[model samples]
Target: MALHLFSSIRGHRNQINALSRVVARGEPGHAYLFEGPEGIGKDTVAQALLARLACLDAAPQAADACGACRSCAALLRGEHPDLVRLARDGATIKIDQVRSALGRLRFDPVLGRVKGLLVESADLLREEAANALLKTLEEPPSRTVFVLVSSKPQLLLETIRSRCQVLRFSDLSPDDVAALLVAEGVAPDAARVAAALAEGSMHRARSLCDPARMALNDEVARFALALGTAPPTDAAAWIEQIAERRATLAQAQGADSDNAEADEEPAARTGKTALTREDLQWLLDVLRAVLRDVVLCGTGIDAASLPHARHAAALHAMANRCDIGRIVAVVDACQQLEQRMGINPNPRLALSALLVEAGLRLRAT
Candidate 1:
């Protein structure tokens, strides 16, 4: 497939500059950890580098391989002998795949000066895969460059990490993200939500750029907002939808959605229940956003000051009823819940306990 490049995120100026510098110097390293969240365009940057390296043209800019050259076109078409991409077919990049890729990496480029091995989602590397790739990283073939992309650097072993140059990618500013999304044909409201929900990852915004997730997020946001006003209202309908979403995401992994009737509480049965785990976590995320606005509000900043300030005005208004410190605690608790999502059961109970704990703290003063 031809590389579908995106207009780079604006704040990635330093990354782009650094990539250009690497290409200009013809000094691409043996190993690099392009560490950043999903959708931040690490893949795009890496491809641009590959294009520069693989371009058949050995003109003055041969080092920054011309995009139109035969080698660059071959890379774009996924036919470049020098360009190798090893991505996890699923959740994990296994040892066998790594060994096979390493075997292939030993070969010279049929069309270019260098061999480029791109490992997408390096975090999924099994320990053995990491070890298998280590020797090559330590003693790479001449003109061979290894680029590994990861959203979760913490999951990688430090020894392997120690051998590679680390490049960190950050979340983009909301305005930058919004502009990018809008440019991609996202509606204004969609651009706003995708940027906010994306939390700085362009892949996330683009992947979730779908109408269903956006609509779901809107419902979840609206429901979370409603909870601030009255806890005893039609929370059931909202939670049922959240459970369905949780099941959907889980099912995508081939996990069974065994949400038996007994798993629900008395209140849940009546459609007036507390939040589900998914619902609670999403609420906490929204609450965190709300509290952020509170912090901004307390600082005398305008409600429109945030990345999602337009969508955050009501959240800021809700924040007026919360203490900053309390909001911090709320965020901490939400993080805890996020970390504990798979481990916890009885989603409704977890949500209720979390809410009670947060309510006691928020309503304390």
Candidate 2:
């Protein structure tokens, strides 16, 4: 089955409306930062904008891609020569790729008057590549448009950001996501939970439609609960957790018993909730989410209103123990550990430090 290209979906009508405003204005700038959570239609917005730019009609301020038009039809088939997108998957967009793509954008379009370069996962650009991108963003080709889409816009350099028009995409309401899911044949209850946990990012929410993501959610819950509530004081309890965590990781990694056991024995540490580096990073992400939810809850942000209420109870409980200020500090600590872990990549030591710090701040009352 074919997926709705962002605006065709019911939940994202408002977003499409906003993008229409940008295009209708015929803004002078050709560079834009399409910022939003994952799967919120940044790429779709970029496409629609690309179509609108090439569109001759001046009516309909909310004018989007004319799906029936030649340009739109070509784009729908992913055959438009005018649309050149650079997306990094599981790696950074190399400096060469960025440079070459920009060079290609300089040419006159094969059919359409305007050309677009949509760089998906823009934040994955390495430092050198990002610097290269900055030059083009500063002085973009007149007939070409550049759209940078990212879930982590902060990863980009400030100078590069200054050159582009920034458009923010927000998550749809749970009611909205649920309605879409139900329309697509998902059960009402399941859609609701996915919407809540997706936290406004429809991409994530849709991915959660799979039963596997639900299992991942459960694992995250269990790990967080054990870390927060269960004190792994002795090496024996730590070993038990190691066994459990390794078992989970093994399944995720699709490891044979021999290989899984090998990684577990040497790399895994004992005593006091020793989390593996991968697990440590994951735990840090989970903890940060928890802290974010704690802040949200304490601020009177109800679970019903937020996306991804899966951990709402945990967030609320933690909020009851700590204030928002403390929660912010905890989040900062988690982010710091995540960076340090990236450089050090020491799971046992990293896990110990993070948990110990968080454990100390467990009760900020």
Best by TM-score: 1
TM-score of 1: 0.68
**Worst window of 10 by summed lDDT in candidate 2:** 256-265
lDDT of each: 0.67, 0.65
The backbone clash count of each candidate, in order, is 3, 5
Name the regions of candidate 2 deviating beyond 4 angstroms.
1-6, 9-15, 56-62, 180-185, 212-250, 253-365
lDDT of 1 by residue, 132-239 (tens): 888788788888888888877898888878888999988888777888889989877678767766677676577556676665666655544443454444443545
Candidate 2 vs. true structure, TM-score? 0.59
Cα distance off (Å), candidate 1, residue 106: 3.2
In order of appearance, the predictions have TM-scores of: 0.68, 0.59
* Tens digit per residue, CA lDDT, model 2, 1-365: 01123356555566667666666676736788878776665676666667677653435564644556666667667677777788773356898888878777778887665787888878888898888888777777778888788878998888878888887777777677777777879766567767655666666566567675456555555454334344543423443465466546546645433321232234444334434555555456655665566678888999654433666676577667665676687789778777876467454555556666555565443
